[model samples]
Target: MSGSLLDLVKALPTDPSWGPPTTTETMLNGVPYAAFSKGDKLGRMADWTTEGKDREGRGGRQQYNQRYRDQIYGAGPALQTVFNIEGQNEENTFSLVDNSRTTIRTRGFGRGGGTVFRGRGQRGGPTQRGGRGTFQRVGGRGGQQGYDNRGGRGGRGGRRFGWKDYDKPQRNREASVQPKDSWKVVEEIDFSRLTKLNLETGDGEDIDDYGFLYYYDRSFDKQPGAPTSVKKLNVLERAAYNITTSNDPVIQELAERDEATIFATDNILSMLMCAPRSVYSWDLVITRHNNKIYIDKREGSSLDMVTVNENAADAPLEISEGNKDSINSPAQLMMEATHINNVFPLQTVIESDTAKREMPHEHPFYNASEETDPPASKAYKYRRFDLSLEADPEPLHLIVRTELDAVVKNNISGEDQFLTIKALNEFDNRAQGSGGALDWRTKLASQRGAVVATEMKNNSCKLARWTVQSILAKADLMKLGFVSRANPKTSNDHIILGVLGYKPREFAVQMNLNLNNGWAIVRTFVDMVMKEPDGKYVLVKDPNKPTIRLYNVPKDTFEEDEGDGIGMSVVGEDGEE
Candidate 1:
């Protein structure tokens, strides 16, 4: 029997509705706010950051900060900005700035060969029988007299021993851990002070509180081409520059390590207006002692004081459990430590494009009869820079060291310098065409080293761009002598973006190079300084001054020019070679 009964009713059309706006936008902590899909906030906080205002100490601001504190703790979206020639004017798009690139792109496939995580012991099955039975006996004669030879029979054997009852030798297992001395004196180092302090003011005077020190007893001679009227810094201004640029001995030691192979590049040292809010260090170690108190080991390089015990080791002090997670050692504790080590407090901008571009070049015709050669694309620029104060450099330096080691092993040429532009170009080309699989040589660099490097380079670019956007930001720097009026009248006019007023100090910028395996060249002690203020640090100007200086002693002792002018150098054919 087939029976089908259905009640079908049609309803009238209704007006389109979004259903009460799935989430109503509340003012970010009581101030008018607008959240963009890109994770950027257009609100009072961003406005206050750009303009001059006291963000801390005030009741509402403090409460507002505490309420939305989670914003800074997570990895925020990658910072990106576009620099293009505006329709209004294409001629002066990148004026008063240096254009150069440093690139490192390596491709391969495989997981990184680092320590892996495994549970300490095996899962449960059956408990092994415990007794000193050196050897399992088969029958009644070999069995002990008092014990049951058969199943539950104390005397003569009713049955022989079974295979199920035998116990195998238990293997003793241990994990590969750092020697006790590595963490013996667990000290709680306070790294909170390591971050930029009193950053709001941006005045030279506020720098003293953060333990910024200079390289005393060392004289840095001004290069010959430096501007005539160098902005003679005030006492506090000089001190501030001294401290920020001051060389840290620990950083120096790390760079000089026998394993380290630095390749000095053109764009290693450059300046930015604002620093990233937080510096992360995965290598930081923390430990728990019998007292239940935690200890921390500061791993990355920042200009912070390190305390040591009388024994000359890091002095351990008590820390809160919250901080225990920032430590790196004791693999068992790694998962727990991730929480504290992952805070991002401020959105960091990192441009993915390394500005690695190709310039078209045609072979010059020596004879009239020769056919015109087609234009070829040649590698023009590549940059590798990162803003990580602590953890970033370790991976970067390590990658360079490994790359150099490979060149040495291959020994393509009799020279020590094996890393070359050709090899780097090949890497960049291969990386562009390949998917994201890291081989042994590139595994570590891919996961951390390259990422950190790119972030730093991108952030520096962002900071420079932001500096010009806000007059208040430039004003603060001007008050501190970082930005000066070119003619004292132009000070009220448009500001120059990259005119750095201060001479650069302690920057650990190094690169390794092997151009055609000629010589394994190591260029170290490179720092980026602004073009010496042509008659003091000027903000505004008639004709713009040179912006950047790529300061480094080349591997060749014979080269006369040590610091190349970034802005002065022209790019195309008729320009400086």
Candidate 2:
């Protein structure tokens, strides 16, 4: 390396948008640890989130540590922006790389712990033999069988037993009787063998086990806990996507390949945000063009100033917000996207008929034989989002407002459609308790104590502002789950009979139910409109009478800590985004 003033540099663009660098070091379990604390090292793994599930035997905790849905979902802050959804991609099953990971080692506890043999205990308590002495009372000389006795010191404390001294002291002094190692230290990294999806949905919907999180990821953002920023997708009516680049090899490679930036807004901020993962410590990768290095990031000593030195590295390929002209005016960009839909890895550019109206162009990038099937056009709601042609482009979103009358009318007769989803089951990784399937595997409803409503704003032109009518008519419904303990020391130990914390989640299927064709919707309305919810609760399931139970886990209790929450984070606060 050169003895230049700028020894380390950053490759990611800070201007567009990067997630705010994270400093809080903790597992998805809220267990805190230093990011680089050597004491917390678990071999080659440096920043691994957790080991596996341990929520049963050890007081509701499992022998292993596992990542929470939010932890996995939050990992793709950058990916969230470019992708359709964010959350555990568990069922989708994939690896960061194209091929399955090459290593796997799964070690689990044997079943002997739970089995018991009848007729006798493992060993009778204690036995006494050989020359046992008897004691006699001595008052005056010949009162009664007078005798004094002393017995051997109660044999060896052989095989001491009980929960406390569960296992007796063995021969080896160096051997440990109590285990202090967390299962984390022995966790196996089987490459990509196991199936688990860690993602956050860009759209508001809880993952359904049947095929939830099957959606591919295309975005990555770095920011958390700020005014929420959403993922960006090309609508059926939009042409062209955005990409940002820097001189660093990693950054350039990612942009060149259209990999979503970990810092989501990189397409917007120009050079202000920070990327999450980095190759080295201290500083991030900066530019390497023209033989000079630009300022990479805040240094330890002086977190503020930049010292621009001579031909130290290469002057950044003269890139900065002040320069770089490939970006067209927002007006030009917007005008260009009136229509066009595309997928990746294409040598030829495919433009739709709608795109031709906004920006006419002959198909110059492809051979006629290479064109694939055209995508069907979906309805574009410019009127809903309140996008204005007169305003300059900015980072703010223009929330769309749809008219209730138009919405209802469109629902009944319009051709445009939206995606809808309903929950059928939940996936439990802990597999706690007994009864193979029910112990840790069951699909139950999860949501309630929430509200969903639409708000309308008045604008003189009616198009100036708008209203957002929630797809669902009412919210705060109910759902169920297994596992009762509120804060078990171990999640795996939380073995139980049934679902504990039951709540209602706002489950909506974007694909509208053809109201005219479905009578169930009509029936639900009868109950809703008449405030007779219980009138339809008791349904005949063959003939057996089943009892209904209502209970709440202490305040912040969860079902399986892995997915334990009032509502899976996918459904927002109050089950409304």
Candidate 3:
């Protein structure tokens, strides 16, 4: 028998088809085949107890087998086709529901490391957990408390613990004027788009000048926040007017003569130009007649009111929004600020009929025969700016009614220098919406630069508007008064800290205010109105969004309100009511 086996082996080696199998013959029946290394460990072909053993934390054979499967076979495309089967099997249908908690390691302070064990129904995925009490679980129970990094219990709303300021109530301000059903939406513009526009206009030329200016009181320019410099803010009764574009007699006269294609007051124009920096809502009425556009504000519009910290991160809250402090409310603060601005300029000027600088024409809006009180120190200059482009067939022009508050004689040149006066009021630094302002009483003297910078940040919109107005009027100097409350709790009493003077153009450069961008904004709006037919339009900033909307309405839109005297108040020549 041994002799017969040796003969058969010798015969197999000699035969071509029966010798050791060639590399090309790698299939058995219809199954693909591949060679495996002898050192690789083989896993069980069928394990029905894996799910039960894995529940007891002893089995995860599939995961372990997969890790080595790639290492042993190299996981290349050529080998993958030879090893993997195409048809479905029992392994594909098998499913294991894992109820076991997961253990995750996080970088911990001092020690080997930290381990965070997740409960079965925890929502968040595996992530690092640090700090003493930082484990947070969600969606398990309704009122269960969780620990936060700040060592405080989480609220029922699932809010993470931190500073209590995160709990600030939402601000839901009402629109300046609600849209009526009869109004049709014309265009909607975002502030972001307005910021990119730029159109350079020439230094405006004075079309006509009216009213007179009182000489500024140099005493207020002393060291601000000093005990000697502080003065009580008094309520002065003077005839000041803030007439709209169409109502002004000079603008009407100019419009009749076809002086310019557009007309707006300095206040209304500045607001529209600085629309990108504003946070609060305001509306302007644009009446398009023939080919002219007139920008006007509503009678009792918030545009006339000076806002307190309107650009602050935590702006003054309304009383209806659960704010306990009524003095710090937005409405009360606006009223206080408006009162200060109205009376501040009046007080800062030396009121003498002889030492005043009278314009070419008499006071446009003030009437001594009809009024008992003397008119406030104000001068209106109707300036014409060229807004024409080279591509246009006709030159476009804009006439803006600009105002000056006081006049000062230049000591060097012996020439009269015009000035625009505005006041910045401080409520309370410790208040909720103080915008991280310094204590004006204590720091204004020592750190005036820091205080002014803080005010610039907190009141960017207000300051920008003032700067724009000062530049619009071509004032030689812009006077900013730092006024603070006599007591933090009292809104009625205030004291002037000091007055800081700045040249309008230089101040505009410092504030990074681009007049070209403002002109571009004006021209863009003018073009929009010019394209539409003769009608009444309203341009309104959205209350809760960074957007402005243009609406087309009937001619008698705000007429009823004006006739009834419901929401209209006459603003004086000093731009105050």
Candidate 4:
């Protein structure tokens, strides 16, 4: 029953857990999906949103987007990369660390508080006879002339009353979520235009082989020393063609109240790239419209369009042939094929001090998707990057610069930033571009030299070591069994890995501090994640990346909580033991 690495990875979450209290109000076919304001007809709560349908479409494969309620919007957690450093170079001999630590001082009991009694002598000044103060002598009845006081009518007095002690009301700390400036809009928007008359396309969602969900705006590229913005989600739209009668309660209420907080989500899908394989110059614009992005990809040469119409069959012509879209993709298409290559397991060039490390056909880093930090190494170089268009200010470009520097400096912390792996493949570093658009590919080629230099400097660092210790206590062994193996795969780099490039953009959220419209960028691209004898994630070159632990969450995910004692690397030779 000993815990396995695969066991922990298998416990990760694939999708996010979302529900109410934190969920946003939404509507699909007039049905409510989440809590929404009742005052605004459109539920315009500053950052709130709703969706619409494309009632102006001709037929299947048209650019028509029918609004629907997929799911209520929960405040999705911000995306981040965790950085961690591991201790290595434990010496030629095995350096075993004792798991048991001695606590100098135990933590538990403490002196409790006592009542400040003042009764009689201890509290209240000796209680007055009867109640508090029942009597107060009135000098002489009414001070009329001496004669008027025949015999002071027994002086009368006002009655006394008591009040209860009060204290201030307390506040619930967990319920206090402030407004967020960032939002993410994931669109499987697919476009493929055949001609001015014919079109064919599909949703990127169902397409398995290739698809992209990048931010139109560079908003999360805040790098080291650059201004960074907080990132968050912005859309809650679904296919209205599939919605039920009552929309999400919150969205319906907001829209009914004439209140809305929608912005343009610039996502456009068309058959512009449809001509059997020909490229089509396409344009589309989408504003944040009630949590969902109100796309305006309507043009003369376009197919269908989503408009503000309650009817699904007939609506205003939002898309036309020549309508210019504010956020449209330029006419371009790369070589593409209809068939996808078969999926196969990746083979690693396992390293060994003496014995070859064998993986149980388990994915690299336990999960091919999860990015666990590599320990420091004598060398380290990341050739490619996955730049976000969401980094605001400083430009996605600036963010890329500063962040890369921070990574080298081992300073991956604070806002919109997390440690992520560009490539899990220990493959050679000579591979070319992989995903995204022209800008991304170009950035990859441009930053290759710079990324290498940065990696080289760190890899050559004299101060670096990694120490990994896995053990089972007496109780743990009785229940979970013993640590059966000591397997670690190190990277080798004598072979050619994939190529890399860098392109930075703005933060996913707008940064108030940044004056630039977009974030700076840096990109790294490759045909594959290389696995050589030299690049096996040795601890010598790993820098200040955060430790992202694998939790037992039943989904493939990363937990911010640092465990496994990773990312605690030492620099130079004579460092901590």
Candidate models: Cα lDDT each: 0.20, 0.20, 0.80, 0.19
Q: Which 10 successive residues of model 3 have the least lDDT summed?
A: 107-116
What order do you get sorting by TM-score, best first?
3, 4, 2, 1
lDDT of 3 by residue, 1-577 (tens): 3453224333432334543443433367877555332233554354444333233355367566434433324223454644544423545887878856776544332222223333333335565344434565444334434554554534544444447777777787889999999999999999889999999888989889999999999999899878899998877778777677777778889999999999999999999999999998999999999888899988778888999888887788888888789989988889889888888999999989788998899988766787778888889998999999999999999999999999998989989999999999988899878888998888889999999888888888888899999988999999999888889898767899899999878877877889899999989988999999999999989999999999999998988766332222343443345
* TM-score preference between candidates 3 and 4, better one: 3
TM-score, cand. 4 vs. native? 0.15
Candidate 1 residues lying further than 4 Å off, grouped into runs, are 1-251, 258-462, 465-577
Worst 10 residues of 1 by lDDT: 398-407
Question: What digit string (tens of lDDT, one per residue) describes model 1 on residues 368-473?
Answer: 2532431111111111222112433342221010000001111364432111111000011122111122231233223534522332342233222222211211
- All candidates' TM-scores? 0.14, 0.15, 0.73, 0.15
How many Å off is the CA of 331 in candidate 3? Answer: 0.9
The TM-score between candidate 1 and the true structure equals: 0.14
Candidate 4 lDDT by residue in tens digits, 544-572: 11111111111111123323312122221
Model 3 lDDT at residue 278: 91
